[model samples]
Target: MPLRVHDTRRREKVDFTTMNPGVVNMYVCGVTVYDLCHLGHARCYLAFDLIHRWLEKSGYDVNYVQNFTDIDDKIIIRANETGEDWRELVENNIATYYRDMDALNILRADKYPRCTEFVDDMISITADLIEKGNAYAADDGVYFSVESAPEKYGLLTGQNIDAVRSGAGGRVDGTGSGKRDHKDFALWKAAKPGEPTWESPWGPGRPGWHIECTAMSMDSFGEQFDIHGGGHDLLFPHHEAEIFQGECHTGCSPVVHHWLHNGFVNIDGEKMSKSLGNFWTISDILEKVDPYVLRLSLINAHYRSPIDMNEQLLKDAEKNHTRLMGVYKAALELMGINCPPLPEGDITSQVPLVKSLGLLEKMAQGFAIAMDDDFNSREACAKVLGALREMSRMLGILEGDDLGAYAQHCVEWLEDTAGSVLGVLPTREQTLVEPEEDPRRAEIAQQVEELISRRSSARTAKDWPAADAIREELTALGVVVTDTTEGPIWDLL
Candidate 1:
């Protein structure tokens, strides 16, 4: 099947008929960067990366954009709590987010625009709204007239706009910003003391939470684009607001061709939250497990399905990741020794293995079909995994010259599709860093080395308790010692 994906707009499977054939303009909402990224953030971005990768593999040139909400209420609050400048906090966390995502092999977006940096564009858009009589400035700030747009403003969230208006009206009638309807959201907020401010047409203040996305997206991707994606939670007021603002700003029928929302990463059966104390920072999990394993586990379930975060699930993900890698390695080896040239005339016997390319092609086709059919990543992932397993049996072993060659092909294919296109895979260097150990730490390393030698002697002599005690001591010192078929190898955990 051609690149069919379920467009959330129509609520049906449709081919991703790009406005321009062979070129796709894709955009996804990125992190706000006030805090460390959580598992929920990881799943959303990773799913897009896969889509980006697969598209590139399937021969479409994708121009990807992910924006950062740097200047927001959360950032300001986080900055004050930590005694750091708000902008500095945003920059720091954004850097950290990049590092974690990079380690997980997620590709950097082609453009990562920040809200604060695009103040002028925001002013221009806000001015357009007021000029069109769709917005008005009040005593405290400027608000978008939700009533001016229409009563059907809650189409995205499927909630009643009138109910939302009546409920929000009584809460904060600060300084008499007379909104025609209670559902009218802010476009600009009047500057509060000690908060960041930009020179706007309304006054020196920041863009409102929802307005940032509309302004930045229009500035970067034009009035309409192929896809707009974010967390499921944003489907309501956030996304709905964007649609209303965009359509008002530009006389467009649909602000986005497709709307894709990934499901939440729940902890246990409940939603993860700070109060619940079940939220896992992506970086925190990275320290305890292979980052790829976390990603694999995230992908094991369909992207749209809720993922429960648990220790048992993580452990299974690690094992499953290793198995997938092993299979990929095996396939590469087999293809290296016996596979024919790409786009070449081939003979028989290798058909089952070589023809497995057709299976992979089918899986790719199925992936597109499922994706077009409501972004069904669950079924698409199954196809990819199934094809990977079938091709593995054709290889003689997971390592050797043949395996290496086959691996190179698969890696190249993945790089072109998953890395370049999807923006999912990080670079494969294996080594993370070359460090300068502290002198005292170096001395401790030596002591650990000596202790390990003694432990090896104990193990040789079958002194089980002594060996176990020494191993435990080493582990306490932040050392991880592994016993491979080649014997013990030690490293700082």
Candidate 2:
């Protein structure tokens, strides 16, 4: 199936077609660098990361650019409260952003243009808007004239512009600034007492939040790009303002081809908020949960569906991660391949594993179908985990070269699909490492082997009751025995 995506503006799933074939110029709205990233931020970025991976996997050279709002009201507030320089505060928070994203295994964008870097471009755009009669300068700053382009008002949010104009929905209001209409938003803010300032045609002041994205994205990818993605919360005033500014300034009707927005991350069935005591920073969550498990938990739901994050969700993710990795490690050991500390290099260079197993091929096909359908990672992840479970059950029955080759095929399939696309599996070395050695390892191994021997004998004699009793005893000892065509094999649970 061809790639299909849910376009936020059209409110429908359409075939994803880039302006230039085999190339995707994608821009994702990034975090404002004032504080550490939270779960909502993680969810947004992870959704894009999955898209990035799949795009590249499907043979598209994706030029992904994500910008940072380095200069913002929140940064200024945080700096003043902490008695730190605003620049220093922005730098520190950016560093923490990288640390958190790296922990989640999110791929970095090609360019991270800070809003401060594009101040000159922002001035030019704001000035052009004024010259073209799309914006007007006021005592406070320049503001976009929503009246000039009334049609673009509800392109993204689907609000009734007539109702908003009539003040029927309580949507229209004044900002108390020197602006003509309440629907009009600021293009630039006038200089304040101690806030950061830049020389602009409007005055010596910083750019507004919405204008920063417009300047940075256009500067990176020109007047038009393929995709613009952000959180659902940005679907309103933030993104709507971008549309008005970009199209009005450049005379380009659609600045972006496809608009994508990920759903919110709710905590325990409630919106995550500091006042509600449910807010969780990425660092705090990583401290308690494994990063791989956290990635699974975040992407387990469709990107357009709200994820209710709680202890139970995380525990379930951990269990799934454990089961998937357990089979993967066992397969590598059977193949006599010791996984190095890093990922196996260049999956494409390796020869495709022969499709001798029907289950493996079915998994590959099912995974592709799920991912093709609007990057349905939730379903894709389910297919991977379910297939691995089946492979684990088949591990013990075969022996010698057949077993070894089958194991090798399973490992390669996993590395190609789950590791490459989902980003859920860990490196080979991480899977093989144990946190601590069991103190009674030798005694337990011996006991398990003896019990397996008895169980094998009972089964050979057709004494099902004796074999079942011995199996229960093994379970009590934290051991699981799989009866294969060759014999019953046991492993520590």
Candidate 3:
């Protein structure tokens, strides 16, 4: 099946094809670099990272470009509040951005152009807009005249000129004064006393938020590209203004072939917000959750579907991730690959040998089918992981020569589909290191053993209530107790 994507501009799912046959020039809107990134930022980047991986896996040379808005009103405000230089603030935030992204294993883009680096290009584009009568200079700065291209006002948002003018569909840029129309957004702003200033045709000022993206993207990939992606919130004035500016400047009708927008991240049942006390930074979440587990939780839902993040969701992802890691480790060991020892109570048992012809091929095709359908990672991940678990169960039953070959095939299949495409699986070398022993391991083991002894006594005495109470106590301490034919066994949760 050919790759299909949901185009935000057309508001439909369409077959994805690049302008160049085997090359994709893609651009994604990046962070503003004012503060630490949050869950929403993780979702947006992880969505694009998935697309990037699938594109490469499907035999496309993807030239992905993601920009950083280093110069912004929020950056200035944050710098002022901290009494730090705005440049220093942006640098620190960008460093932290890379730290968080690298921790999550997101693939790096081909180009990461900062807004400050492209100020000259922005000035030139703003100047050309003024010369072409698409923008006008006012007392405050330069503003794009929506009247100049009324038909292109709401190309992405589906808003007409009346809707935009009424402020019903699009955001009004209220930074600059003396605008001829309420919908006319700023191209450049006049310099303020303490803010960063740059030399431009419209006096000493900085580029506006929207213009920075247009200048950086077009400069990188020319007037047209294959894909432009961002969060759903950027579908309005931000992207709408980009369409207008790009078309008006380059005389290109459609600046991009496909526009993709990922859905929002909701906390509990409501939108994530600082005021709601549900705003979670990526660093804060990483302090408690494993990076791979967090990645799975984020991609469990379709990219276009809202993900209601909560404790249960993360816990479910953690369980699934642990299962995958266990299978991977066991498969490696079956193929004579040395790996870190599994937990004390974890055991692998041989199942009945079955016909395994075409199994790997079938699983690979199934994964591709799910991913080809608009990057449905939720289905793709489930298909791959479920098949791997079954394969691992059968690893012990294979004969001498067939055993090694089959185990190798299973490892390769997992590496290609889940490791390369989904990026949820760590490499064998990455997982080979022995984890540091916990200081409380001896104490916790003693407690667990004592509780299990008490529970066993209670069970033998026919005291169901006491046994249940001890079991609950063990569960609270993150231990899972199971009854076997011989005796009760326990494992750390």
Candidate 4:
């Protein structure tokens, strides 16, 4: 089966054929670093990260580029409010963004181009738009001529242009008042007092938010690329403007072949946005729950569907994640794999060596089928759980055994599929605690070890009731306790 993706431009799922076979050039619109990232930011990146991992697993060399709007109106405003330099503010947030995303295990983009790095390219593109009559310089700034590419505009959203034109009247910045039409958007904004400015052909100004992406992407990839992705909120003006400027520059019909947009993330049934005052930051949530649980809560839903994020959703994700991790650890341990205790448990034992040939192959097929059809992660996750269950049953027949070649192969495949590809499972190294990890986590580890020690003492004294109480307490804290000849082991739920 061929891999399929839902192209926002066509508004349907289509087979994904890279413009260049065996290589994927992907650009995902990234953070505008004025504040800490939120759930909405997490969802957008998680979806694209899933897609990037899947593509690489499928044997395509992927060159991924995600950008940062390091210089923006929001950054400036935030800097002024905090009495920090605008550049310093952006730098701080960029570092914090990396911290949050690293905790989630998202792979880093090949390049993270900041808007300030490509002002020269922005200037060149703006000049071409003016020469081609696609843009014009106003008293305050240069604005894109919406009528210049009338036929191509609004192609992605499919919204009525007339209605948009009417709705947009006076909704744009006051600077756009001088545009040829009310719907025309700014390409460059003349510097205001105390704001960052760069010398441009039009005047001393900064590039508009939308134009920054085209310049950055074109610098990294060529005129045409495989996939362009972002949140659906950018579908209208941000992305639509990219299409207009890119196509007008090179005479290419579509600057990017596929347009991928992840759906909105909500909090308590309302859209989660910083402006809405109901948004939750990724850092805050990470302190309360595991990052895997956070990732699961986001990916559990179809990427193109809205998910209402709440406490229950995260609790449910934690439960499912714990269950899968428990099974995964037990399956590994059953093959005589040894490790430190976690918060989950498992067991199956008693039989002779049997051929487990092609077990992994069977699971891979179903998984690929689900993921290929428009990257259906919900269905793909189902495939993963089903595979683990079958493997667990197979392990049930063996007692204190060293896994045979086929069983080891099955185990390796499961690890790669779950850990590397989906990024929902921890690698062996990750499962072990790092000495330099957060102090809070170290304290939690100490607390868990103390509980385990007391439980051990109770069992040695043969105090069954006290031992059971500690075990029950551990379970309530989302830890699964297991006992073997070596002693008691636990996993985090």
Candidate 5:
């Protein structure tokens, strides 16, 4: 089956078909660049990153674009409060955003068009809306008339135009705002003193928050694109307004083919907010948590499900990440590669992993099944952990000569799925810094393996003292060894 996602507009899981075959044009709503990014920001970006990776795995040429709302009321307000230049503040925050996301290994978007850079495109779109009678000029700015397209105004949110008008983000009816209706949203805001202003058809003012996206996406991908994604909070006024404004401009029904929204992140069993003092920024967490572990924790839940942030969340992610890393590192030490494992085969295991490779290939198929069904990342993560467990079990019993190719295949699966695609495995520099920090640990680990091999030979031949002596040497070197039903497992103390 082809990829299908929960379209917020359709409010159903529908197949994602590209207007052009094998080409997916996806746009995600990016950060507004006013302050440091929090865990909520990480959740949203990680969801789309997984989507981007899966599309590539499925052999599509995906042109992914995310935007930065560089010129916003929030940015302006923040700058005013801090007594800093708004453009400087925006530039600094954008740099900070990249620093936070890069640590989590979030893949960079193809284009991050700033709102300020595309003001002309926005003005052109607002003019088209006004020319079509879909918008009207007011003393404050040009407002998109809610009554302009009654049949299509609130389709994204499933509310009728009337209900929306009453609760249009607190714009009350008969208010002195000069709007045709309370739900009427602005396309162009009239310029204010000491604020960044753009030259628009109406006057010197900046574009409305909703108009910025519609103009950016429309100019980048024409009238329609494949996927539009953001947090669930965007479903109402922000996204709905985008649809109404875009469709009104081009007479197109839906500006985007599929709309995907991720659920929110709650901190410590409550909604995360600055007022609640529970806001956890990504930078603060990265100080203690491994970036790979952070990525794992985020992927543990389905993207559409709200994430409950707690100390245990990060702890469990750390444990799971360590376990997977142990398996990969152990498998590699057992087959011996110190970096991201490369098995000299296709990523999908088309050519077979000896016999174990075949099982891994089937596991890969199961991973795809989850991802294909609305990008069920939790299910896919389960498959990654399961494969590692089976590989570890297989590692214990197989003879060294026979284990070579089979282990390589299993390592390849781990590398392809959990390593490259999920972005969990540490890069070369990170792996080199793991404790012992010794380039000679690999040699020492190989020595341990040889000792273990000798002990096994002694046990097979019914020589107890030699086995005990080898075990004593391992212990003397600070290696902790324990016998499992499968075999003996060792950890460096």
Candidate 6:
């Protein structure tokens, strides 16, 4: 398959004929470990997770690498506030990140390089840049000579570099005495009192934020790779700097074949932040709703479109997710009866639940087409839901008999191809916690209610032993029964 991906350099679609046949090397910017993962991070990572799954399904050998910015200012500040070691802070957050990713069913990357671990590599790259006259060190720190690089610095973002150069003057944290221009960004920061530092030729210090990625990417994926992805916010100075570092050192343009960026997520018409009090932690939301609801809400919007995070959107997404699962179950049941026997050398034994092999196959095709058309997950998801609704009505998995043997076979294939391969499913076993009011829950509630009523009656009748036994049994089952002015009520333990 000839994949067409959006090339940020050209600001247009580009054909992805690989430099090495059937092999794709992808690098994505990962979370800075200052805080817990949020929905915004979910959107960015899940989008690429889907891409990774699709590439593998299409028979491409993919080498996916993501990095941890474990040495950023945020991590330092967080550690200082808690009086903990900076490395400890990052390690704890990294552990939390893995748990969240596992819960979401996002696959692990082939390599998870931490910025601190690659300090030597970063030093080498910075030295190379200095030797090539693309960077310089000052009394404060080393900085990249942005103007020394090629004039195509703004090509990827389609912004004129000169137009924005003036306002950028105030943004530089430290004034690098050797910097020829205000737009020059730091390559390394000189170690300060009580800050993390490593020995380097330039002095004792650490790699700057942008330089870490450039060095790590070069070390892991070499001079060029198939794809580079991150949030849209990184497109301007960060990505431009990365391109500059790669090209100035290696004398190559278009260091990456494709660039992908997911749009920002907004909460209540504003970007999420600590100041807004609307910033939600993944752990916080997990307590209130299942993770799949969060995943569905993120993927429902186009990966490049700004998502307005609101309760209405999530409620609708949850309903859609439930309806989709219900439909898939129904379709499987229908296939059992209606599907024909598979001939030899066939992939599926049953007729596809939808006109396609399964609703997912059609969705997968549509998803590829949308992604090819600039990663439009919104349109692709709409088409998938439509097919799901149609097939669900025919199959009756939600409220019908066991799927026929043939339908079961088709369901397994489609579920694996779509759910496992694409990272989109109505219900994953890990995220599918029983609802508070599920029938089983209700049954337990009813039994508890009956027990409370019986206990009340038993107490009134002076049968103290029966009442005590009922209360103990209910308590043992995680029901804290209590009597109140209104009536008896229970709370889940």
Q: Estimate each model's TM-score.
A: 0.78, 0.85, 0.87, 0.85, 0.84, 0.80
lDDT of each: 0.74, 0.88, 0.88, 0.83, 0.84, 0.77
Distance (Å) between predicted and true CA of 262, model 5? Answer: 0.5
Tens digits of per-residue lDDT, candidate 2, 1-493, equal 7999999999999999998999999999999999989999999999999999999999999999999899988999999999999999889999999999999999999999999999999999999999999999999899899999998989988998888878744444445688788788999999999888998877799899999999999998899999999999999999999999999998998999999999999999999999999999999998899999999998899999999999899999999988888889998888744432222323243322232366567778899889989999999998898788767876867666667777877888898888989888788887778655566656698888888898889988999999999999999998888977878766667
Model 6: residues with Cα > 4 Å off, grouped in runs: 165-178, 330-368, 396-406, 426-493
2 or 6, greater by lDDT: 2
> Candidate 6: what lDDT?
0.77
Instruction: State the lDDT of candidate 6 residue by residue for 82-175, as single tens digits.
Output: 9998888888999999998877778899999988889998888899999988889997689898778649568677777777686576655464
Order by TM-score, highest first: 3, 2, 4, 5, 6, 1
Displacement of residue 46 (Cα, Å) in model 3 is 0.4
lDDT of 5 by residue, 1-493 (tens): 7788888888899988999999999999998999999999999999999999989888999999999999888999999999999989999999999999998999898999999888988888888888999999998899998787888766777887666556576556556665777778888989889988977767798899999999888778999999999998998889989988988998887778999999999988999999999988999888888888889999989999999977899899888898888787776656633334334434445433344555666778888899999999999888888888778877876665556655656667787888777889875445545566455556588888888888889988989999899999998987777877888877776
Could you give me the TM-score of model 6 versus the true structure? Answer: 0.80
| Tens digits of lDDT, candidate 3, 1-493 | 7888999999999999889899999999999999999999999999999999999999999999999999989999999999999889889999999999999999999999999999999999999999999999998899999899998877787777875567644233453486777778899999999888998867899998999999999888999999999999998889999998999999998988899999999999899999999999999999999999999999999999999999999999999898888777777767644433222211232223333434456667889998999999999988887787668667856756556656666778789988999999998987655665566655598889999999999999999999999999999998899998989987767
**Which predicted model would earn the best TM-score?**
3
Over 4 Å off, model 4: 165-176, 274-277, 336-360, 400-407, 432-493
> What TM-score number comes out for model 2?
0.85
Q: Rank the candidates by lDDT, best first.
A: 2, 3, 5, 4, 6, 1
When 2 and 6 are scored with TM-score, the better candidate is 2
- For residues 1-493, could you state the per-residue lDDT of candidate 1 as single tens digits? 5666656657766767877779888878888999999888998988887777667666888888899999888888989999998878988998999998887777777999988888788788889999998999986678888778784476676777666666785654563655555678898888999998987777788888888888878887788888888888898788888887889989786878888778789887889998999888988888888877787777767666788978888888767566655654443334455443443212232544346445556666665666555445567556656655754554544345535555556655444433353333444443223446766567687788898899999999999999999999999998878887887877776
Residue 257's lDDT within candidate 3 is 89
Model 5 / residue 291 / CA error / Å: 1.0
